[model samples]
Structures are given as C-alpha cells and as structure tokens.
Target: MNSYSIPRFTMVLAGVLMGCLAMAAPDQPPVSAEKADERAGALLAKMTTEQKLELISGHNQFFIKGFPELGIPQLYMSDATQGVHIRPQLSNQLEKSVAFPAPIALAASWNPDLAYAYAKAVGEECRAGDVAVLLGPGMNIYRVSQCGRNFEYFGEDPYLIARMVERYVRGMQDTGTMATLKHFVANNTDHRRRTSNSIVDERTLHEIYLPGFKAGIDAGALAVMTSYNQVNGEWAGQSRAVITDLLRGQLGFKGLVMSDWTSVWDAEKIIKSGQDLEMPGKANIVKDAARLLAEGKVAMADVDRMARSILRTCIALGLHDRPVKDERFLAKFADHESVALQSAREGVVLLKNNGVLPLAPKGTGKILATGTFMEKLPRGGGSADVLGYNAVLLKQAIAETYGERVTFVAEPTDEQLKAADVVLLSTGTLDKEGADRPFALAKADEARVQRAVSLNPRTVVIVNSGGGIQMTDWNEQAAAVVYGWYPGQVGNRALVEVIAGLTNPSGRLPITIERRFKDSPGYGYVPAGEDVGKGLKRGEEMAKPVYPIEYKEGVFVGYRWYEAKKIAPLYAFGAGLSYTTYAYGQPVIAKANAKRGEAVTVTCTVHNTGKVAGAEVVQLYVRPAKAPVPRPEKELKGFAKIPLAPGEVKTVTFTLNPRDFAYWDVARHDWSVAPGRYQVLVGGASDRIAGEASVTLE
Candidate 1:
C-alpha cells in the first residue's frame, strides 16, 4: 500500500494517542520500544506502497492547495517565531496574528521573562489563525554574516543562546502552539547553505552549535527543522549524526524533525535518517519509501516506523483538533511594550565613560545630536525584519529624555560642533546579510566624527549595531561611547535612563569589536561571494581568484583571540562602565579542593565609593595554573550583576562547576578536567581582572 494514501489524519490521530499512552510506561526496555514501534509499523505495513507514498508526498488539499489526497484535509502550518509573518495579501493570508520583536533583540535582553512574554503574545496570534505548527524560533548559530537569515538567530555565545531559546520555546508551548526549534545541527550560514558543508570539528559542534537546540528540546519543543546546510559532510536533512545521533540519541529529543522549506535533497535518505516531513512541497519521500518496502529493498516496518513518527509529532502538537472559526485570536494578542522596553535597557552597553556620563546637570548642555542613525534608523534586517511596528531612535530618545531645551542636528557641520557643550553622535554600521559587512563605518562618517571631535573635544558618540565595528578612527576623539544594538520600540527610553544615570549601563559586549577587520578570527575565511575582491565591487566578482576569507586566528575568537595575541581592542568583551566607581577586594575560593562534578564558589567584596548608584557585572574566570594543551589567559566561567548605591558594600559570589573549567578532550571523546591549581579572577571584563584566588580540582 502507498504510504501517502494511508488512513490520513484519522489513523494518524489514533496512532498518536496510542503512542502517548505507551510513552507513559516507565519500565519500557529498548526491545519493548522497538517492538512497540514494530506494532505501530504493522498497521502501516498493510497499506499498498502507492497508498503510503501518496500520504507522504502531499498533504490534504484543503490546507495545501493542489495536493489532492482522497478528500482528506491537510494540516495547517503557519510561520511564527516572535509572531506570524502572514502573507501581506489577504487572498493568500494563512494567518492573522500580532508579530513580536526578532530573536536577536530578545537575546540582548538576557531576560527570560521578556522572551516568554513575547512568545505568549505570538502564540495567541497563532491560535487565532488556526495554525497548528509554528515554523520558527530559528536557533541556528550566528557563525557568519552571509547567512541572509541572521536576524532570526539569538547571538554568538552558546550559554546566552541557550537561555533565550528555552524561554522562547516555553512561551510558545504554554500558549498551546507548537514551537519548532530550527535549522538543526550546524546550519549556521545562508551562503550556499543548501549544499555547503559546515566542516566544524566535534568539540565546536557539541559545545557551540548544538547546546541551544539541546536546551530547547529539554524544554519540550515540539518540532525541529533540519537545515539546508550539511554537517561534517552529510546534509543535515539526511545526516543521521545530526538528526539521529545528536538530536535523538545524545540530546534525547523526542520531537519530530522536518525539513526547511524545500530543503530536502534526498527523500529516502532523509526518511531513513529520521526527518519526519518535507515542508511546503510534494516531493514524496514516503511514497519512495513505500516503493522500496514493496520491492523488498527496504522492510515494510521501516515505512511504518516513519509514518508512526510523523503521527506522533502531529498528535503531540495537538494538530488533530478541528479548528473553530472565530477571530478570538486578536484578543489574546498583546502589544507587550514592557518586555520590549526591558530588553532595550538591559541590552544597551556602556562601552566607554569618563566623568562625563549620566549628564552632570539635569536638562543640561546643548547636546548636538549628529549621525545618520538618528534620521535613517538602523533596524535588524533580513527575512525576520519587521516593517510595521514603532521603534525608538537615539535622536527621539534624547529629545524625549532632555525635552525641548535639547538641540538636535543631523550630520552636524564643523561650526555647529564647536557651538555645542556636549555632542551626541550616533555612529555604526547597519548589520545586514547576517553578519558585519565589509564597510565598517564609512570613511566619510569617520571624517565627520573626526571633524566633530576636533571641534568640540567633548563629543560623545553612540554606536548602533548588532555586531562589532572598527572604532580605531573615533575612539580617541570621543569622550564617551555606548554600544546600542538594534534596540526595539522602547530603545529611546532605555537610552535616556543610561544617559540620566538612572540606569547604570551594565550590558556586556556579547561579541568583541576589533579596531580593524584584520583583527577578527575569521577575517580571511569569508566565502568568495562576500569578498570585496579589493575594490572589485559587489555583484562584479570574477571566478578566477577564489579569495577565501582567511581564518588565520582560528579558535581565538572574541576576546580570547585578541587577549592571547596581546592585541589591544578599543573595548574588550564583558566591557561596560557606570558613573560610579567599584573597588574589588581580593577573591577567595570557597573550597581548596573541589571534585569534578561539584561546584566551587568564589567570593569578593565590591565597594561603590563614588557618589552615584551604579550596576556592575562581577565576572568570574578560571585559568589552569598548569596544563598540557594551550589555553587563553582565562575563560569566563560565571558572572553576576550587582547594583549598589553610593557608599554601599556588597559581597558578590560566583559559583562554578568543575565542568566549567574543563576542555573537550577529543582524543578521549570526553570532557577532561586537568588536575592542576586554577586561578579565579573576579572583576569587570577580560582585561580588568581586579581580584584573584587559587583553587585545586582533585
């Protein structure tokens, strides 16, 4: 019997309910699990290979037009991450829902509460549209810039990404909308993504690329989307290591795996590897699988197992429930302005400040606002970029905060710069094409900043961007500078708080900013299409010279790379400052000898001696005093954000597990803790280690 023509939604629902009930059993052995699968497979095995093939090839025509299948209705799938991107034209309008902020902005907030709030609102919007499965919360690593879909990603670090992904998934699931954690495995970039192989080693793949998805899975994400890119050498859609070995075997992901939109390359391979569904297309992997079964090349049990897997996912997401026709989804949709505002405040980093910040006088000094970012705002771009919502620009933020007395000027003239007591110049590149582009702050803008600095000498410039920038030209010229990535609607208000000294900027730079492009780890490893070809220009590339972006500084990424090279950056990672001063006492470890699995605590006293209230991030780093393999000066193990008023003294403590200090020993295929004395440094950023203590792991 054809797998495509199997009892459709009716039997799928029955299978799902049975599977759920069976899953409740605790003492189930592997043989029992396989036997249960075989039993489920038996039902599918009775159908003709052609019938089974039809069910797999096309969904019901009611939901997906043109794919007719025995009068059965297709399951309604919708697009949603923060919210649904419904087709703008109503005729093709599949969903009508309230959209939320992109994930990248959410990651900056570092607040799970905001992530849940945003997701709940999006889920409400989804429910109204009768969308059963939401296609997103795209959690691919921001490996490179050419990935046209980076706006959907969270950030660079694995821990930060994990936090955001878990919250987002929980939010969507809470609203009864199935959240799909997507682009499974190492599907990092979009350049040649469908076929390009991500040649990442095992350690990088496990630690960095897979953790967020692991977190989402543990949080009960219903589905996973296999990416277009290949991992190691096999396509993620078909790679057993990615789909079976890692996602299912290691992470224990019980959810169904689906392909990206038309991302399927091999039907039988994907089906065998455990990809449950091929998205938005009628390419029949199930039918092909059924044929293989009838031909005796593959067992009928295999086809049954695949069908049962798809049925289980549909059941788990509760897709079997019939839709109720109503517009009630609108009421569930919330604007969620508070969450957006909170994210912006926490996301903005105070990179450089000298006594000039927190504006000495209220409603003070003629602030000459200059920079293109003020007028032509820089928004997170690409497939996930939202066009209709309200946003707060720096100019608007300053004006609202300082009131009518503030003077606003765009692209300030040299004379205008001299007349101002304090100049606020908003500068930085608008990140597009996934990562930072070739032009890091145009020379013209740099000259404008140079001229402004020469005139006022009290100029304060703010960098607006998602990633880092080349600050070599303007760092010396500016009195203070802030890094504000694409802050959402309440960005203006947050900036005002930091400026007024009401909210001390405590955001750590998620990624490092190099003084020049030459300083980046993957500076030379860029794809041929991304290369400017030394003034050859965009869209005029010649095939002859394949200038691969040289990744000379391998594994020395972020501050670790720059620190090891002793190359100074304009600002370091975990770098932020406040109006008040913080003094750190000598660090002391809680235990002298700690075991591998146990956590070691470090304590330090921080005193706010200055006359202003401020917030500080007490970063804890651990370095092996002696080790065989090379290591950075230190690796960030843990951190705590503490707020203190003037004259306030508080003890900030950070706890670390031995695994935090361990490195992946690929040779042993396990995380190894080198037996040695380790130094614990507690301070601000990587460069400012103020307090130190030593501990031993036994």
Candidate 2:
C-alpha cells in the first residue's frame, strides 16, 4: 500500500489567517475531529505495516516521522509551557521567541481571558517557528512548591487549574497549533528518577489531580504527554488503567497520546496501554514491538490505533497542507510582546504594603534597589527556560522609571539602607526541570534581606519564583513584600509600574506563600536518591518498583491545608494587596433550594473604597455541611476578577455547576453530589471572605 491521498479534509484551514500564517480568525473555526479521523483512516488504509510502525514514533529529537510518499510532512515539536522554548538545537534554526511570563505568574492573575491571550501569542510564535505541536499548556496540579517545574503549571486547586487550562488549550489550538496537556495523572515532582510512583487514591485523583486534564480534553486539546512517574506502581505512559481506562474511556479523549521523552521502557506494555506515540525518537518500542505482535503479546489493532491517532491529529491541524514554520510570522513577535507585558502587569502580586507604594504620586524619595539579577533577568532553569532577546531587568526598569531618585547596589551598606527612603530587595528561587529547589532563599540572600530590613524598616522585598517561598524569617520585619513569580521578559517593567503606582497590583497568590516550607502539604515530598530504593545502585534508581511519593496531605492542598490545620499562611492562596482598597457586600443567593444538577448563582456587590482604580478578584469558596464523605473544609468553586474605579460599586456574580457540588465517590466509581446545605463564601481573597450565603441542594 502506497501513495494514498485525502485532499478533501486537508484544506479545512479555516481558522488561521491565510497569507500571514497568523492566529485563527475569531469567526473561522478549526477543522472537526470527525473530518480529521475520516481523513486519517483513508490515509492509514494505504500505509504499509512498516510505515505504520514508523508513523507512531519520533523521526529524530523533536519531530514525528513523515510519510513523504503519501504527502505527510515531518511534524515539529518543542519543549515549553510558557513560550517557544529556546534550545541550542531547536533555536539555532529559528528566530528567538518571546519569553512569555511563566504560567504560574499568569495563574496569579486568575484571569481566564489573559491566559487565553497569553497562549494565543505563544501559538502564533509556535507557527512562526514551524512547530506543529506545542508540547504544553502543562496543566499538572501544583502539588509542591519545591517541584522545579511548578513554574510551568497552574496552582494547587483542581477547579482553578481546570478553568485556566481550558482557556489555555483553546487559545493555543485556535492558532492552528496542537495544544498538549501534559504529565498526565499524578506527575508533580521533578526529583530524582522523575519516575517516583505517586501514591494516590481513586477519590483523591478525581477530586484533586484529574480535573485540569479533563478540562483540557473537553476543550479539544490535540495531544497528551503521559507522565514519567508511576501511578499505583505502574508507569503512567504504559499503564492500561491510567490511559485506556481513565483517559480514553472515562474522559473520552480521542486525540494523540505520546510518552514523555525517555519515559517509556517497556515496548509491549506501551503498545497495549494505548499510548499512541513514543517521543524523542523511539528506542524501546521499534526494536521489539513487531516481535511482540508476532508472539501474540501485542495486537495489530494497537499499532493501527496509534498510527491512526497521530495521522488524524496531523490532518486535523492541517499540518499536511500548511507550512508549519513560516519566517513571515517571526516579524510579528513585536505584536506578542504587549501580551507578555500585560500578563506581567496583571500577575505580579503585592503580598504586603504599608503606604510606601505609589512613589510616583506621593513621596518623591530616593529608591534604593539591591539584588542579584539586577542587570540579568533571572528565571527558572530547564526545558521551560527561554532566553531574552530584549528582556528588561529590575534595576533597568526601576532606573528607567525613577531616573535620579533610584540608587542601585549589590550588597548595600547599612548606611545606604538607612539613608534611602525605600529599599527594593530582589530575591527568588531558581527552580529547574530535573530537580527540586530549596524552599527558602539562600542563607546569604536571607541574611542580606535581614540586614536591609534591620537597617531600614522601609525595605520593599520582591521575591520571584514559580511558587511561594518561606517568608516567616523576615517577612514580618520587612515594610512591604511582593511576590513576582518569574515574570518573564518585561516583568521587571510591571514590577516597577506596580511600585510606582502606574499599574495597580492586582495579582493574587495562586499557591499559598507558606510561613515555613515544613508546614506545606508537600513538605519533604521529593525523596532523595538514597530514598529511591534501599541498596539499589546509583544508576539503577530508575528501575521498577520505585519508591512512591505518598501524597499524605490528600485533598487539603494549598489554602485548604492551611485552613484545615489552622495554620496561618504568611499570605493565603488568592492573597494580593492593591494600592487601593475594596469592600464587599453580603452575598445573595438566587434561591435557597436547588436541584443537584441545576446552577446555583451567588451575587455580591464590590465597592472600590479607595483613592485609586484597581481590579479585585472576588473568590468564591464552597464549604459543604452534612455531606456523606470527608471533604476539604473549603474548596474554591468560582471566582471573578473585576476592575473598578474609585468609589464605584459593581455587582459580581458566580454560578456553580454540576461538578462544583460533586465529590468523587469511590464506591460508585464516579462523581456523586450529595443533597445537602452548601455554604458559599465570597470575598476579595481566600482568607478575607466578606460575605456568605447558604444553598440547600435537593
């Protein structure tokens, strides 16, 4: 079988801008899955067995094998969640990409539309680089603050992650690029082995870990990369229960499923598990897959299924007819830079403040800035690492903004600290891909911060990282504190603007900023190499029966754990201070009684009772009473970010849906909603609930 064609389905390039290779037009929709499958099956019927085997694996490091004889081009993929990942091998051949703010930073904004805009810019860059598949929108729930790649993921809650990721998937896919939701099912840590088994219960998995992936699938994500870790003693990539049973059957995801790079070792198991592709070029599968099939260990249907999925996605994305990489799109990166700037502006959270901000409108005192990464922009390391083409630095942006009033120093003397009206101490943790990072700032850096605070209680501490860091040590002493989570490229500008009152700080903490890392749910979660397996050799840590990472905290993740344990977080999840103030009115429920599947609407009025205009994130948390099973004390169900002018009052409403009131029922093997009274708390932040209303579900 050879030289097959499916021309009808190939030209459905409706979404993308025809000549510019730009983003999808708002009115023009992308091709349908049924059309893609139909076209793929037509092509698959004509492929030889050898070609079928080749179609399901990588051609090289970052490409899928193309069927040139049949007109399928080799598909290009890239590493990243935030931006077009720049690598020596990958970037050398293309224009430098915009280092969009890390998704964690974007998560801080709690704005779905911003997330969509952020991803659409990334997708445009993806097409500009000829990348057919953008291997992210990595929506793994942030389990631990120490997890190096937490920067690439949405924060702790399943509900928030789900909402953000759905928009992220649509944004990326809308630009004619395939959006991949990754590290499927309990892949949280980037510790030793990257294969530590995640010990999770069925109920916990559904209630906590699975919602984001389900949302992405529902949003029509084109690919899913299986996790490197094992879920219940089985590699997620090669687990039939995880893939075929849960992902495909339960979630009904028919898109392409691929293994993480070097994540699969067992060829027979991977083929049978319904993992459609082996990435970074096939090794284990290509060698022994045919023999396994001949020996009745694997079925030909499995191979056909894998090949068909990859083909369908490629055809559906119009990769066959469209040019994946176009130099024309590179010139438009300037246009995407604004989105990066806006994301940063919206995402840098002001953790604490005491009237020292808005230096522009009020005090015209000297600004003393001290920190490393003053000239060089510091961001997390590894696969998500993106180099700056024209990134601004903290010192540069501050100096550029405040000219002669700013004095910069690396390690300022006590006199310098006391002499200045305000101190900007820039500090953050540099997390990476293959390992966990320290939960606290380095001792010397901590000492510097302490010294600055001691000398001058007017220091405004700015810490950057993917997630929260230990703040109990000096946060109390500091006059003010800001959490700028690895805000990319133009992030420094946003920080300066917030400090200067040009842009009001509205970004909230997506993850809780713990007083101490030890109090965290994921405290000591990443096992050391020695903890992998007793008496196992150094290199053999990757072997099977790997030691499991027990999620001891269960459903009490982030703010839930803090509230449940009665531990006061330095700043709670959804905690962010603004230059202005806002007050909330009592929440009003549309109806006291509602059906299980019916919508529950909670409305509240927020008054901007401050001197300036700003955005307020109205968080809605659900607390159920008299439920059958154990539940978190409070779970974030819905939220709205509203911008208001000073002295203006605006009404904000949140609607609860079927999944909002349901919990994973282990006995039923499904989501079950209990008929009971549910409390809805609405406020600006999680800890600052100003209003509550009760709804009785019948």
Writing each residue's lDDT as its tens digit, candidate 2 over 238-274 gives 9999999999998898889999888888899988898
Q: Which ten-residue region of model 1 has the weakest summed lDDT?
A: 1-10
What TM-score goes with each of the models? 0.81, 0.93
Model 1 alpha-carbon drift over 4 Å, by segment: 1-83, 90-102, 112-114, 128-131, 142-151, 283-303, 321-335, 360-364, 433-436, 527-555
lDDT of each: 0.64, 0.81
Candidate 1 lDDT over 1-698, as tens digits, reads 00000011111123212221222222212223354445445545555555555544435421322122332235556664655666555344533343344566566555554566667666766677666667878887655433445557776666667767887787777667778888786665544445456667766666567778988887778788887666767777777778888788878887667777656657667667866666655665743665666677666555555556655455444443345223575554334444445556666777777657766335556777777677655655654454435655667777776775568876567788898878878776655432335536677877777788778888887876656667777688678888776665556666667766666665666556678766655555555455431322223322233222222343445676788888887777777776667999999888898877778888899998877665666778778898777666777676666767778999987778766788767788777889878999888777889989898888
